[model samples]
Target: MEHLAELDKKHFIHPTSSIQQQQANGPKVIMEKGEGIYLTDINGSEYMDAMSSLWNVNIGHGQDELAEAAAEQMKQLAFSSAFSTFSHEPAIRLAEKIASIAPDGLNAVFFTSGGSESNDSAIKLTRHYWRIQDQPERRKIIGLKRAYHGVAAASTSATGIKEFQEMAGEMMTGFVHTETPYEKTADEAIHDLRQTIETEGPDTVAAVMAEPIQGAGGVLIPPDDYLRQVRALCDEYGILFIADEVITGFGRTGKMFGVENFSITPDLMTFAKGVTSGYLPLGGVIVSDHVHEMLKEKSKGTLFHGFTYSGHPTAAAVGLKNIEIIERDGLVENAREMGGQMLRAFEKVQSELDIVGDVRAKGLLGAVELVQDPATNKRFSPDQQAAPKVIDQLHERGMICRPVSFEGTDIICFAPPLIINREQVHTMVEKLHDAVFAVQKELQVKG
Candidate 1:
């Protein structure tokens, strides 16, 4: 195990990881297996998967059914290109299944390998749709500040997170970002959207893309009517509304899609993550009937856009069975119920702990904001790296969660599997309480 860890440190290039830390610490936790909501490391230590392994393992882990599905499809037909009239049963059936559960009028599916490709595809398709309408000047894509689309060119350009852009060097042009709705009420945000449209000249804007609840940006949940109002604003300006549901789709928000929670229909919706419960890589964009109709009428030649693994048969097969598991096992309802319990647990922790500033949860997605002074909402010094310290304590206490140190605040985020039960929720809360308390004690001792 030590030799393998050394090999990982020497050869593996991880994403969104600190290269310096990886070289210094080698591999922190070399996981060997996962079952339900817990993971076992190579050394036989267990830890609760509070973050659902990058917020994608909605069905938990170690599901033999998904493996069986993949194996069955591989035996029949392993790979096939989705381009040029070539199609397969798994891709066709998965698309049909996704469309059936998607929002009204969103019945067309364009498959991608994962979230990044799905988002990038949406951007290209949106601009192409406008060009087909003979409105080539409508090329701008508007996104929300603090939003996280993906890492690809178009997706990263649409992202409002500055770090991604800085690391990736220059970003693409014609992508504008507006203030998040959390800065004000839904009505205020609507007003701001109107101002942006008027300032940018609405005719030049092709679409306005946003996440119903910003996942990586600290799980920022907007006002209940924010999406509905955004949909209206897009319509008023003749702009397409795109919902990036990569993290909140496939029952993460206790619904098939996050837009469903807001009772709004977007022209395009990008989805991934929980689509296959992270059993395999699979994602796609759901096109509204209105948009599809326009493409059919205005476009003459081929779409001229697709991926080599757009609809990998094995991934689609796993997705099919994964969805069946989610539906049959009632995981969505479980997420809602468990999320409520988690919220109440966090409320209790906040009332008892002085460092706990705020607690928020929607379905199974949640965040615990830590502050130096709860009364004043004072943040810890950046040098303190308080969130990471608390996360280390969580690891010591046999739990795994993410520390979000962005937007001038430190927060611990949680997104446990949808299949988590009441007992697991209680255990997670208890461990979290202990971890936070430990961090508080260490801080006090240092002071």
Candidate 2:
């Protein structure tokens, strides 16, 4: 603990962490390793990785085969470029594999370092494709409020969470925002979206981006017909639809992609996170043939958009192998099966808790939202960190679950590894139940 505290206080700069609190109380450091769906800290504490290590780690942790694959690639060709006049076999093979798995008509791939960069690339491609089609005026990209795209400029513009933008002091141009379909009827949400488009005018709108199931936005599962309605709305408005599958891709939602889970195809899809299971940084955009062909044929100039690490060989090799493992191990099928069991467990627990507002689950992804009064459907005040307290208690009880507080609501997200089994799910629920009891006690004491 001495070494951990010293390092965290002196050197570690964490993302989305409260640095002041961290410096005062030190970090929650995991010293050693993980295997399958479990992790052991330096203090010999074993816990379930309930959030799948930030909703990645699809194939779970400590797969020696993955390590060996990465090691062998490093030995043979540690680094290479995929820029013009230079392309690698692994990159080509991975691209082909991605194209095969991606929805029909999305035949082209442009790689990036992670989800953020992939989303950024999608923004650029959307505008670029529109420009090539001689509609440079169609540059307004609409994103749902509370959506989490990424922290980069363009991607952040597509991000609707207020905290990400509050300190930035401003927003990027050409990024329009609409209400998320969460907690709203599909028809009403669609009507509101139509109104937004009318207010902005369709000619000014270029693309509309969404998550099939809002992952970072409190794991909000919309009405069943929402994505289909969004598709129809996009088609009617002549707007390209982009599915941001950063958290839901690669079998997280019990499907290879979230778009498949909802049965709605987008013109473009951005993927990252589980692609390489966070073992390597790899992400990209899958463009429809229409957009791909337009950019290839009608484009007047060079693509002029890419990263120095685009299609990094080592990452591509790892990603290719990752996809293979996901397919071979039948993790997607497992996710679907375990998801049913997990949702039932949550439902049973939900029935016992008066504070439980909503119990939503799809595939391996699920959430249990808290409220002030369930009968009245009254939510707790946004200032109440009820979910965060539960998250902290869960960690103390030897598990990791994300307490999503987007828009000041309490939704505890459960996204375990696809490799998790029924026993692990039971263990996770038991620990979460204990944590919820403890949090309720704490809230009572505070009150």
Error of 1 at 164 (Å): 0.8
Against the true structure, what is each candidate's TM-score?
0.98, 0.97
Per-residue C-alpha lDDT of model 1 across residues 208-306, encoded as one tens digit per residue: 999999988888889898998999999888899999999999888888788888999999999999999898888999999999999889888888999
Instruction: After superposing candidate 1 on the true structure, give the runs of residues whose Cα lies further than 4 Å from its correct spot.
Output: none
lDDT of each: 0.91, 0.87
The most accurate candidate by TM-score is 1
Model 2 clash count equals 0
Model 2, span 1-447: residue lDDT tens:
788788778988889889898888888765488998888888888888998888899999998878888999999887887777488888899999999998888888999999999999999989888887788899898888878899988988888888887758666898878877777788878888889899998998988999888888888888878889999999987899999999999888888898897788899999999999989889999999988888879877567898988988889989999999999999999999999999999998788876778897889999998887878877878776889988889988888889888766899999999998898899888887888878777766776
Residue 195 alpha-carbon offset, candidate 1, angstroms: 1.4
TM-score of 2: 0.97
Whole-model alpha-carbon lDDT for candidate 1: 0.91
